[model samples]
Target: MNILLSGWQALVDYLTIARVISLIIAFFLSGAISTFMSKGAVMKYFGPNAKKYISYAIASVSGAILAVCSCSVLPMFASIRKKGAGIGPAVTFLFAGPAINVLAIIFTFKLIGTEIGFARVTSAIVLSIIIGLVMSILYQKGEEIDPNENMFNIQEENERTWWQNLIFFIILLAILISGVKHPILTIVFFVTLVVVLFLYFKKQELLNWCSETWILAKKIVPLFIVGVFIAGVLTAIIPETFMVKFVGNNTIGSNLIAGVFGAFMYFATLTEVPIVNSFMELGMNKGPVLALLLAGPSLSLPNMIVISKVMGIKKTLTYICLVVLLSGVVGLIMGNLVFY
Candidate 1:
């Protein structure tokens, strides 16, 4: 009975108007990326042959503006991958979107210690790049993009002007970033975006954007909701005492436990900081704390389910393993060496 209630409550909490609005904005932004952004542009920026340093750098830093949660990032991730982005850069963007969220990092610096906060930021960026490179290397054969491919033939005409598209995306990003936090400002930005759309974009383009967004929403949202409910049920049943007992020491085993636990748990946006602080007060080690921070925001149950649908089960599992392993190893290093 309690578990069922917990699941229902999770649904209730997640379906708040603010979150719903933010998610809708994300879907639209994702649609714009898929429909309006030319495939040539995507390939030039994130294709396999693009400059490695530049691609990874863009993928990592771009997350700063998104400030989204694990599940919220899926539509964008799916869009980029669907548009023929290389596995490496797409994966980097996926990890970075939630992990390196600017607002969440700021919250970490304020609520958590400066040292751990700094470690979290640096580690997430480094880990994202490393994981992306490794995945690209491992999956090279399957992901190879032929230059002559029809997908790459799609191009944007120079006459359309880049700045006009830039302003359009900027407004969409503003609405997403503002969310429901500044309802009036969000409304203003949304109205502006609508006006820009009607004036600057063709009717067919607008319809295509809506179609792409609806397709992504249909594919991801149902699984996202189910994963949230299951996570809530698991939250109700899991013993906090057990978590605390296993992660008190900074041993590799403890870090691994923390990493695995964090990977499967849901932490909405900036919530991980206060939750980790509470666990620290209850005797959690700094290493495991870092491990949790690294894994928590980037890989939730809801996140995993949606990612599996976007990529295949094999790739999804590999990605999960990589994140959990890297998080544990990094946490162990921080605890045993840096913090010590």
Candidate 2:
């Protein structure tokens, strides 16, 4: 009874107005990102034949814009890979797209701590690019360019113009900001969001954005709730001494375990933030937290299965090794820098 009550109390405390608003922001922005970034654009710069520097740079940061989860990123990864994108850039985009999105980064900075949030974004982008480059090198053969392909291929007839997409992103971002800021600023941004919505997005686009947001919410929200409940139960069941014993050390094995655990366990987008935050609150080492943040959003069991089909077993293994190794190394560095 005591354990059950503790869990219930934890859940109630977790569901603050601010967090609810943040979740809404994450869901809607994720949808907006999906709607705006068409397959053609992703294919153009990230295609196999694109320049290493330009393509990898774009790939590294693209996830910040896309706002997908591990599974959601798989389809995009498959699309780019199928379109003959270089193994490196596609893989970079694959890792980056879901792991380091703007909304999640902001939420992490706000909910977790400023330092870890910054570390999460920096390590995610840097590791993604490094993994891509390493994979390309190990493979030794860049993909062949298809010169006959049209550069301006449009995947959808109903896709909005680039400016329209920009306005939509800004308006939605303002809504997110409104949720976190002072009441006066919140009111101002809300008014701006309404005006922008009325002035810019057509009726159909508005509906499409809403529908996309709903789809993401439906798929992710229930799982998020369960995760929070489980986290609460964990708080009651797992003693702080035990967590500090295993995860508090900044040793290589500790970081490796964190990376591996993150890879195998499924974290539904921003849920990783709170999950990690909860663990951190319980005295989990900062280094392992960094390791988990680096690996969790980009790799999962389902994510791995689909990746094997998309890129084959050997390549998939290479990618996984790179992610885990890089995450561990970075964790060591971060542990020394931040907490040591």
Candidate 3:
């Protein structure tokens, strides 16, 4: 009874923290993205006939800046695809956008260590590019969509100046940095963001934007809470020995298995950090940790379900399998040569 009660308490705490933080970050980042990054620019440059490798490289860097989760990238993926991006390049952007981002890398470094942090970034970039190349070759003659005709443009009429956008970006960075240690600071940051938006834009426009952001939050925050609660329960119920037995040696096989499991498991945005921390306490090896880092953010059960609805089960499965295999292979090599 005591154990169950404690688990329940932990679940509530985790859910509260994760949901609040996720919502705040999501709203702020999404607003900033919609405001600053121009769709015209993206289409003109990364649109069709763009060099496959070059597109991959650009996508990797741009993705790092967005700081979104796997599911969050879906709309952006569809947008770019409609804007004339090839299937392979668009898919690379889809994967890289969430997989290898500055936020995830920084979080890993702060929670884990410098080595794992570097490895995670390296693997995300390399795999994104490689996967993009292979997918391009395989689907070179696949269905091509015209960007101008089909892309969704959710842009609002009001636009901010370049300087204002830059300022907003800087504020977001500051908020994220401060939120790492102090959760309350996030609230302050958000309030300040709202105030800034109100001052800069028309009242009606700001209200509409806030309403949309709230709608998105309502949809995602509840799921995030549930996920965190489940993670907490798993932490309390699962034995440490189980984790140690599989991922303790940083061995090639162990890392591969870990990668496969991570690919299939659902990790809500930023939830993997605490989960990985729990596993580390159980003596999970660095190799497996690397594998998990590579696979977790890019692939998830809920994400797969949603993707399958749009891309069909076959393509979704292929994507998931490829992520697992590639992450496992890279993690194995890095674990032995660099981390060992």
Candidate 4:
């Protein structure tokens, strides 16, 4: 009964107003990308034929604009992948989206040491790109080309102009960033969104957007809830003392354990900063702390389940291994060389 109550409490804690709003905005924006953004546009930057320099650079650093958690970014990742993005850029965006978001980085700098904060940002971007390039090289030939590639070679006449779409996305992102924290800004953005929809978009187009959003929500939300509940149960079962004991030294084994634990555990948005700081206070090594920082935000049990459904078991497992390996190795380096 106590364990059950803990799990229930965790679920309640996870469903804060700000988090709900963020998820809603993420859902809508993902739907908008799928419904409104043209295949040609997605392909131009994220497709297989797209320039590696441009696609990897954009995907690697794109998280600066988004402040979502690992789970919140899944729908958008799926939307782009289905819309004709190649595996490499899609993977890059998936890892970078949550790992190096502006809020997370800033919070790390403020709560954690500036050294770890800078290291997290630099390592996340670099590791994401390396993982993306590796995945691209491994799977490029095996990637199934979209059958409609020829049709999307040119932008459809019905698609909104690029600048118009950009403005619309900016407004949506504003709502996401402000959320409930800035109620006034949220209201203003909402009103502007309505105005833009009425003036610039047709009723049918709006309906289609909502429909796509609903579809993504249906596919991801149920699994997300389950994953969250399970994660909560794990948190209740795994004592913090046990984790702290093993990770108190800056060794390869400790770093690997931290990386693996972080990969499977869920950390909501900037929550990892405080959690990691608390661990450091408990005598956790700087190396394992860095490992957790790298892996915690980018991958989670719920995140893994959802992405597996989107990308399949093989690709999902491979992504997980790369993230865990790289995070551990980097954390080890940071602990031994940079800090020590």
Q: Number of the top candidate by TM-score?
A: 2
What TM-score does model 4 achieve against the real structure?
A: 0.63
Over 4 Å off in model 3, which ranges? 9-31, 34-36, 43-46, 51-54, 61-68, 75-84, 100-122, 141-159, 179-209, 301-318, 336-340
- The TM-score that candidate 1 achieves is 0.62
Instruction: Provide the TM-score for each candidate, comma-separated.
Output: 0.62, 0.89, 0.74, 0.63
Per-residue alpha-carbon lDDT of candidate 1 for residues 1-340, written as tens digits (9 for 90 to 100): 9999987886787677876776677777766766666545544566545677887887775566444456667897887677677888889989988897654675576556789989998999999999888888888668746443455344666345789989998998888778878989998998999899888888877888899889867865676567557656756776767656899888899999999989998877666765676567566899999999999989989889899998889989999999999999999998887886
lDDT, ranked from best to worst: 2, 4, 1, 3
Error of 3 at 134 (Å): 1.5
lDDT of each: 0.78, 0.79, 0.70, 0.78
lDDT of 4 by residue, 227-247 (tens): 556546656676768766799
Candidate 2 local lDDT, 1-340, one digit each (tens): 8877766776798889887887787677878776656755655786545677988888888876555666668888887677677788888899898888765687788778888888898888899989988988987474565543454254665445778667767766777766765677767877777787787667887788889889877887777777677677777888899888878889888899899989899888667877887788788899999999998888888889999998889999999988888898899899998866
Kindly give the stretch of ten consecutive residues in candidate 4 with the minimal lDDT sum.
147-156
Per-residue lDDT for 78-141 in model 3, tens only? Answer: 6666567776777777788777654456557755778988888878888887877777776667
- Candidate that beats the other on lDDT, 1 or 3, i.e. the better one: 1
Off by over 4 Å in 2: 37-39, 142-148, 155-168, 178-181
Ranking by TM-score: 2, 3, 4, 1
